[model samples]
Target: MAERRHTDIAVIGAGPAGMAAALTLSEAGLRPVVFDMNATPGGQIYRQLAAPQVDATLMGQEYIAGRSLVDAFVTADIDYRPLSRVWWLDRDGEGYVLGVLQQGHSQQWHADRLILASGAMERGWPFPGWQLPGVMYAGAAQILLKQAALLPSAAPILAGSGPLLYLLAWQYLQAGRPPALVLDMAPASRYRTLMRHPVRAWHGRSYLLKGMRLIADLRRAGVAIRQGVSGLRASGSDALERIHYRHAGTWRSLPGTLLLTHFGVVPEPQLMRSLQLRQHWQHEQQCFVPDRDATLSAGTNLWIAGDGGGIGGARNAEREGHLAGFAAIASLGRQPTKRRSATTRRLLAARRRDLAARPLLDALFRVPEGWLAEQPPETLVCRCEAVTRGELDEAIAQGGSGPNQLKAFTRCGMGPCQGRQCGESVTRLLASRTRRSPDDIGYYHIRPPVHSITLGELAADDFDNTNN
Candidate 1:
């Protein structure tokens, strides 16, 4: 058992939100301890380039924005813990106790105030042959490019909705390795409707302009662009050798070696849901989001910031973190100086402007109606347990109406990923079966250890002797 360290504030996740929160709390005469799962501070949006690598040309000029945040975090007088995998959280009197696994040791810490900046993960919706070895999420592909300066060893094939897809391909083209094809899931109707709503879309003009710029660049480079693609599948015995897709009602097959896909993102809500915080299903984002104020507080002593609450991109997350940090001070009846408050208010206004275009994106990339509309009984639904759609059908036929109940019946979500990879897919599948909305279907009951921990680590010598 590690010693029970104590602090006034504990911020989880070292991304833009948590670091920004720590910086704000430090300026308010408080020392906040920040913890991150990764070894370094930068989160996904501004992920730090590999150690000793300061070259901006490789990771791109935009990555330079994260340097100041990481630097400010290092200079702050706050305790920072990296490679700390927080597993469990529990209410203890007026505070909270966090169960953490660090460096192969299990430990616990107590905090009077908790800030959750857990960040986001790429949205996963099962498509045919998605489980193939050579297929991966577009976000994962971007990580490889950012962290290792790596590119596909073979021709890259990208498909699905959202801007990230095109952006990653553009980055690949910049690296002088162009993809074999681009299969867009977005139908023409979505863009036509978006153009008609310029009044509401104007607020998110920056995002719109950036997306257009990426698409324009890819087209100029002679990248094959196929819009309104469906029936996407990978075919090969040992690895992906061909991509089968349908465009304009014509079935076609393209030779490819890698298949990258994405459809935007959603928060990793395991920690928030494990805390039993209030959350609701967001139809727009097609995921659950913690209920939070503009200040980002969800409970009296609990605050949520960043994409973990909702997807508003990196800039909005930083602004939200500042608000949540200052709000923590105000909760204790300690208003920050007017200058600080004024700056955060300005950021808050910008955050709102950034959020204005979300509804438009939501409609355009709405989870493909066909995914939940029908399921081929032979297709795998739970990749971890090898549970198939046929098995799920039997479970539902036997009245497994909820995700939790399905887990008990077929072990659909009891996997190493703790349902992160399959929760949305499972929920949508059952929701369709029961003729109810996903909210009515509910999510799996999340318990912790959130991530796996060794048996010996849980029984380490540092545990409280009184309990033993």
Candidate 2:
């Protein structure tokens, strides 16, 4: 049965942004109830270390910083619940009601203000043989290493752009398991786009140095790197046998059992979109982001923070969370005139400087035209229903009105993933064939129950009255 729970503040996700928000709000004398689907608090970026008393040096400075954030959140005066998945959001008087599934039981969690820090998901890079058993995301490989301390069976062949691809290879190299090959999607001329103001670049020189060091470390470990690479395909009759690619106007193949790739990341907006928040399409990030005020407030009762709201890294997300914490507490009618204006100003400035190089990153790591383009008729686009790309195209050709309308024809967005894996690809592929801009194409008409939960859980749930 569902239980009625009242929280002054409800923060979703336990990543850097969520933890930062909870910590800041706690300092301001508020107890925010935090719900994280992950068993631990660090979200993905700061995934908890292998052991409680392990050396932080091995995980690198990024995870070290994440450890500090997790520590702060751990000590905060907040009700922390791990392994809690929120599947629905509803209007509750001036506040909101969250349908949360915790430990296999449903509960109605209420709060005057809600903050979403659900984080981002890897951009899909569908290719031939991608559905094969061994072709997985580079981020997924990193997760195995981070959460379970597991390494690939054999040296991996990484094909993708973005710092994550490089970072993961570097981690493998650092751990004495250098990648077999790194097929970089970035062009040689990408450095030209990085031509930024000296002072601005110098302001973020530490990060710049880190990038150089990662590349240098990987090279030192004898990892083969091929830039401007394209035409990636994984082929195996039983398992992943080899990867084929075209490089320097020639087709080449690499003998490998695993092919890990990622173009970059985009916000996972299923929750935000389901709630019908104000969303805008960010050109650089090539995704829809929820719109919010300076305080991160979307409305009187809704606040969104972190990469789920936008694609800033952990540092920027933490800053946004801090600001949103204040906004949320004030919205809930709690304030003692305390503000972190100076800190917010500095964080915002640093965040801008940090992301100043993002356009270059975006250009360098962009998926090739049709990388997510319509696949062959037999190629699966919607993995949940086994819907193929040709089917999607045919549905579009059959005079489907838009992305949402195609659901009736092909059911692309109605899968268990609810369009996360195939949503962007479907929209882009549709726009390309229809000669319509993506803005004109529109997004999936997402409804409630954004995440999966058992019907038995909902059917047995108790509803709380909001009239009080």
What lDDT is reached at residue 340 by model 2? 63
lDDT for each candidate structure: 0.82, 0.79
lDDT per residue, candidate 1, 1-468, as tens digits?
767878899999988899899999998889998878998887886765335233565445567767777788888898888888899988887788998877667778999999999999987677667788899998998877767677898779999998788888888888888888888987568778678888767766766787788889889999988888866777778888888888888888977779999977999979987888887888888788889976788887889999999988777788888888888888778757879879877987888777888877777766674574464676777788888878888999998889998899998889888888788888888777778887788888899889899898887755334347
- 335 in model 2: Cα distance from truth in Å? 4.8
- Which digits, one per residue and each the tens of the lDDT, describe model 2 over residues 244-348? 987987989978998889888898878888888877767777777788876778877778888988787888788878878877766666543634666667777
Candidate 1, clashing residue pairs? 1-461, 1-462, 1-463
Best candidate per lDDT, number? 1
TM per prediction: 0.95, 0.93
